[model samples]
Target: MKPSRLARDAIVLRRAPFSETSQVVDLLTPDDGRLSVLARGSYRDKSTFGGPLDVLTRGVADVQRRKRSELDLLHGFKITQPWRGLRRELTTWLAASHALELVRAFAWPRDREPALFDALAGVLELLDRARERYEIEAYLTSFAGRVLAIAGFVPVLDACVRCGGDVADAKRGWLSLAQGGLLCGSCSTPDRTAIVCSDGVVRLLRRALGGAPDATPGTAWTETVVSEARRAIDLYVEYRLERPLLSRRLLDRAERSPSREPVA
Candidate 1:
């Protein structure tokens, strides 16, 4: 008997050539989590998969899971949001790529994570409309915070992860990647792997974790705040995932280029 067909709203996370005419695609879906599907003849001119099957393409996929195999056969795909705006800007493209990479790494296959699916969709739209590098950075930071929260690894921003002391009342805080939260000055030690952060940086991180994605803040983020928040979030995520992401390394390289837009 043939495997039953399943359809779900999916966002393409990664796609690579398989053979001369086929491609292997990884997709994230609300109902199905992450899926690996084989797109037969997807690279051909008369292929049913029209347009580009690029990363971050939101679409519906018709697929069938083989009886004894992990890979699914992709019957068809229909694009819903191509995110054309990201393609126009290099920074936006990198930002979207970073988000997709994180999703692919952290999200488990066949596990239902509807909230993460919604967050990725929302972040993609935000990246598509972002006008500045700082904005994209803010969105990426926010996206990371949300994804971590969904994965049950949210860093403690309001209190010390070690002592459970309030961070708001402290003059300075330390971000402990291993402890997985902010550490008050009194609770921190030289031996701990921690990043010293200012009160403003703590506040920004708190807001990023708890605030809505589209809500504009009452105060603008200074260059220091942006840099500090990015570092703290990146370190925390890398610690939780136990490895650094390639997309993040690429983003760092791009930012170091003389021709790249000034993040500050």
Candidate 2:
């Protein structure tokens, strides 16, 4: 039998050159977690795909899902949303890229992740319109929290992991990545893998992980609070994933450089 033909709404997660004229593209579909398809002659003059097959673009993908253990064929991809704003600013680009990296790490081939995919799309859309660095960071932070929680890395934040005492009831709590939660004043050890955090940061994290990562709390974010909250989430994610995301590292460096500009 011929390979089953499928056309799904997908987002370009990543892509690479293949066989000079062809390309290997990674896509995230609402119904299908990730699809790796070979786009034959996509770089040719008479290519079936219009424009460049760029990353982070959303489109309708015409694919042939093979039965045997082989790469699927991509006959066509009609770009729907270029999301050009992703590359309009360095801060936004880095945030968008890091989010994609996190998605790639969590998404399994052919597995369904509809909710995660929707969340990702929403976050990307918001990132494109974001002007300030803090706004972009908030969107990414929220997305990361959602990704981590979905992947079964829920950290206990309301109370201390060691003593089970609510941090709100104590003077303060220490964030312990290894123990995967907060340690109250009485429960924290001198040598534990704990980072001192403020009550405001903890509240920000709680709101972010709960949902609505795009919802801005105030007219403008409390710069310090949002930054600290974002940092804590990223550290937790890195600790759980056991490897630092290269995009995240680059994002940090780019953020520090005042002269950096968005790449076209």
Candidate 3:
């Protein structure tokens, strides 16, 4: 039987050159987790997908599911939000790219992740209008927690993953990526492997994990939470992806440099 073709809205996570004139687009759709589609002849002049394959660009796309395991065909695409403002700001662009990289790394093809999709949409908007570094950081932090949650690696924030005991009173806690959640002091061992976390970090994780979608703490704490949260989530992603994230390294360099230019 022929695989179904669907019209969906998607975010372009990454795009790579295919042949001399085509491009392979990796996208995150609401219904599909991660999809690789071939935008035929997109690199050539007079192309329909010509100006819309940018990372972080949202669009309505026609994707033909594949019978085998290679790139599927992109019958058409229409731009929703180009997010051009992000391009002018280096930090925002780099940060958005890093987030997108995580999306591509973690999500599986043909899986439904509408919540993750909505989160990404909000993150992009936040990155675009972010005035302070904390805003960006907060969004990324929340993003990391949410994405991990969506990927089935929900951390034990409300209570200990092992004993199911309340963690609200604990001053310091440990998060185990390998063990797959939080470990209490009694349950923790020398080789159990966990990240040292403070009350603030724990609370932040708890909020992101448990809070309502529309509810977020004010932007006052956005930066601090975002920075700390980035480190924490990166640790989890590093363990899960099990390889060096090239985009993260690039982001580090971008963060340090005086020249805030978007990397091509």
RMSD of each: 3.3, 2.2, 2.9
lDDT over C-alpha atoms for residue 95 of model 2? 86
Candidate 2 overall Cα lDDT vs. reference?
0.82
TM-score of 2: 0.92
Please list the C-alpha lDDT of all candidates, in the order they appear.
Answer: 0.81, 0.82, 0.76
Shift of residue 33 alpha carbon in model 2, Å = 0.6
Worst 10 residues of 3 by lDDT: 211-220
Q: Per-residue lDDT of 150-193 in model 1, one digit per residue for the tens?
A: 88777888777888887887767898888888887777885377
The RMSD (Cα, Å) of candidate 3 is 2.9
Candidate 1: count the clashes.
Answer: 0
In model 3, the runs with Cα more than 4 Å from the true position are 1-6, 162-166, 186-189, 211-222, 262-264
Q: By lDDT, is 1 or 2 better? A: 2
Identify the leading candidate in terms of TM-score: 2
Q: Residue 130 of candidate 1: its Cα lDDT?
A: 83
Residue 169 of model 1 has an lDDT of 76
Q: Candidate 2: deviation at residue 242, Å?
A: 0.6
Say which prediction, candidate 2 or candidate 3, comes out ahead on lDDT. 2
TM for every model, in the order presented, reads 0.90, 0.92, 0.86
